[model samples]
Target: MSDHDPRPDASALPWSCEAEQSVLGALLVDNAAYDRAADLLRRQDFFDTRHGDIWDAISRLVLAMKPADVVTVFDALPEAKREEIGGLAYLGQLAACVPSAANLRRYAEIVRERAMQRALMQTADEALEVARGEGSFEEKSDRIGSLFATVRETGQRSKPLFVGDLMAQRVDHYNALAQGTVTPGISTGIPGLDEALGGGMWPGKVIVLAARPGVGKTSLAQQILLHGAEAGHTGLLLSQEMERTELVDRAVANLGSIGYSRLLNGKLSNPEWQRLGPAVDRLAALPFAIDDQAALTLHDIRTKAFAIKGLRLLAIDYVQLCAAPKGAPRNHTRNDVLTEISRGIKALAKDLGLTVLLLSQLNRDVEKRSSPEPTLADLRESGAIEQDADVIAFLWRVREYESHRLIACSLPKNRQAKPGAKLGLDFEGHYQRWRDSAEKVGHTGSVGGSADLGFN
Candidate 1:
C-alpha cells in the first residue's frame, strides 16, 4: 500500500465558488445591492478567503457612504495584500462573473447554506480531536456539547427583517388582537398576576423570581409550572439545587393536598394516602419534565432545553448554582460568572421564543433593612440579572410571624404593566401550595378543617 493517504476531493467540501463570485459581482455592479444582500450575507460567509476580504472591503466602503466597485475595492486593499489575492485582476474577474444583481439574494442564500455546512465540518473535526485526546470523559462530553450548540446557533442565523416586513408582522398581530383570537400570553394560574401582567408570561421574556431563603421561590415556580402544564404548555425545569426526587415530592404534596411534612416523613394518614395515589398519577400525566443535574453549565442546559420539542417555558431553579462552561477565564469573578449566566439565560429565552423563569436568592442587604421585602437591587451577585430580566418579582413573607399564612409578592419591575403591584397568596406549607388568598374562605369551612392551619 502507498504510504500517502489520498487527498479529499475539493468538490466534496460544501461550498459554492460561483455563488460567492456572483454575490461579490452583484455588489460591485451596483452598490445598492448591498442593502438587499447585507442581511443575508456576512464577510465570513464567503468560502474563498480572498472573496471574504474583498467583500469586507466593499462593505466598509459602502457603509461609509462611498461607492464600491472592482477598481475602488482594489484601491482600498493594502498594497502588500493585492498580489497575494491575485492582484487587481481578481477583482475585475469577480465583477464580470455575475449576469445581473437580480438574483443577489439567492446567491447570498446559497453562500450562507454552504458556510453553515462548512461550519458543521469544522465543528465535527474539533469534536473528533477532543474524542481522541487525553481529556477526561466529562471534558470531551462538554466539548462535544459546545460544538453541537455552535452548530445549532449557526443553523439559526438569518437576515434581519426590513422595516416594511416588520410593520407587516405588527399589523397581523394587531389584527389578531382586534379579532379576540390571540391569547395575549401564558397564564401563571394566579388571577391577580394574570391581570397585572395583562395576560401572563410572554414569549421571549425573562422573569426573575427573587426572594430570601424559605420564602417559597421554588414553591411559586412549581405552582406556575403546574398551571402551565395544565394549560397544555410543555415546560422543562432545570433544578441545580434540588434533587429530582425532592422536586417530585413537592409536586406530589402540592397536587395531592397532602402535608409536605407527612410526605417527607412517610407518616401519611389513610385519607392522605388515598389522595397520594391519584395525585402521583395526575402529576405523571402532566407535560412537565425535570432535570436535576448538579453544577450544570450554561451550554449543557442549552443543549438539553433545545432538544425538548414544543418546550414553551424553562425554569431554572436558583441560577447561582449553575456553573459557567469550562474554559471560562480563570480571572473571572463570581459576579462576572453570574452576570454571564444571567445574560445567557435571557438570550436563550429570546432565541428560542419561549418564557424563562429564573429563581434567585436575595442578598443579605434586604434583611438588614427595616422593611425586609426584597427589591430588584437585592438580586444577589450581579446587577445584570436585574437589567436582563423583563419582569422581577420578589417573594416576601413575614419573618417574625410563624403563623402568617400569606406570602407577599411584589413586582418591582414589570415591563408590561405598572410596577410596584402587590399580590397576596395563601401559603399552605403542608401541601407546598400557593393559592389566591380569596380562595381560602371557601376552604376554611371544610369538614377536615385542615385549611385553617396557618402554615407559611
Candidate 2:
C-alpha cells in the first residue's frame, strides 16, 4: 500500500491531474524551471500521490543545486515506490508530456486551487457532521463556522492530527528550546516583558496595548517595533496617527540617545551629530517598513502586508483609527463599529500568522474612577477588544509623568502566561526612548549617553 491514500470522494472532488502532471513534467524537462515554482506548490498540492513523490525528489535535487531530470528522479525513488508509479518509463512520459516550461506557474496555480477546493469540500464535510450531531442551532452553527475558519486560519489540517504525534512534536520543541536550538517567539527586547509574555509575543496572537492620549502609547509601541526590527525580524508599522518623518525621528532619538526636541528643532550639538551616524546606519539595516497613510481599512492593511515578504510583526497605532473592510452600517453604534474592526484585526492576525501589536485608547471612564489606571474595561469603544485579544496590557502611571518618567506596563489578561504581570520601563521623552527601569540616562563630556540597549 502507498503512504498517502486517496480520500473517499477523491474522484468527486475538484482536481486537475493534468495540471499536476504538467508541473512535474516542466521541472523534469527543464531543470532550471524549478525557479518558476518558487516554493509555491508543496507536495501536498499535487492530486496524484506519485506526482507528489516526484515533486519531492525534484525539490530536493534542485535545492541541492543539482539537476532534477528523468535518470536522477528514478534513482532517487525507492525500488518499491518506483514500481508503484509504473517504473522509469512513467517518468519519461511525464518529461515529454509538456511542450514548454513557460506555463509552469499557471499549472502550479491550478494544482493549488484544486487542492484548496478539495480542502474546502473536506471542511464542508466536517461541518455536515457537526450539523447532524446533537446540539442547539447556535452551537452547531458556531461549530460549523469554526470549521471554515480553520481553513482560513491555517489552510487545511489535511489529516486528523493525533495528539500522540503532536505531543512528540511538542517534546522536540521543548527540547530545542532548552538546548538553544530554537526560540519561542521574537523577543520584545525587554527581558522582564519577555518573561511575562512567556518568551515573547508569539505568532498568531493579538496583543492589545491601550492608553489614554498624551500617555506615550505611540512612543512605547514604536519602541517595541524598533526592537523587533533590530533583532532581524521583518516588521511593518501602520501609523494612522503619526507622520512617517516623526516616526523616523523617534526611532533616531531612541536609538542614538539624542534629545528629541534638539533633533527635531535642528539644534543637535556636535556630539549628538556624531551619534546620529550609527543610529542612521542601524535604522538603514533594519528590515522594517512603515505605512502612514491615513484611514487604512483592514483590506488595505492585508493587501499591503502581502507585499512585504517574511512579515512577522504588524503594529497599528490605535485600533480606533482603523476602518473596517466593508465599512460599518449607519445604525451601528461606536462600540459596534469598533467591535467589527477588532474582530477583523484578530482574524487577520491569525490568518497571516502574525504577532499584531494592536494599540488602542483607554476610555475616559478610567480617569473618572478613583484610580487613573486602566483595566480590560477601558479598551476604548469595543468590548470585542477584550474578547479578540490574546494579551491586554495598559500603560499605567499614577504619579507625575514628565518628572519621574516611569511608565508601568500592566498586563491584566495574558493567555500564554500568568496575568496581572507588571513591568516598569523608564521613559526618556527627551530621547523618545524607553529603557529598563534599572537603566539610567546621563550626559557625559559633551554627548548624551544611556545604558547599553544591546541593539546593533
- The 10 consecutive residues of candidate 2 with the worst lDDT sum are 439-448
lDDT of 1 by residue, 1-456 (tens): 112111254467888777888898899998988988887678788767777888889999999999998778888888876876676677788788787899999999899999888888888999999999987888788889878787877677566667987998889888997898886899998888887776799999999998877677887898899889988999999988878998899999888988887788899999999999999999999999999888878887788788899899899988888887777788999889888888888889989898999999888897676675666778888899999999998876642224335667778799978887877777777778777765222111111122334242
User: Local error of candidate 1 at 96, Å?
Assistant: 6.6
Considering every candidate listed, which one attains the maximal TM-score? 1
Judged by lDDT against the true structure, how good is candidate 1?
0.81
Model 1 worst lDDT window (10 residues): 440-449
TM-scores of the candidates are 0.82, 0.65
Candidate 2 residue-wise lDDT, 196-286, digit = tens:
8889889999998888776688887788888998887789999999899988998999899888878878899999999999999999899
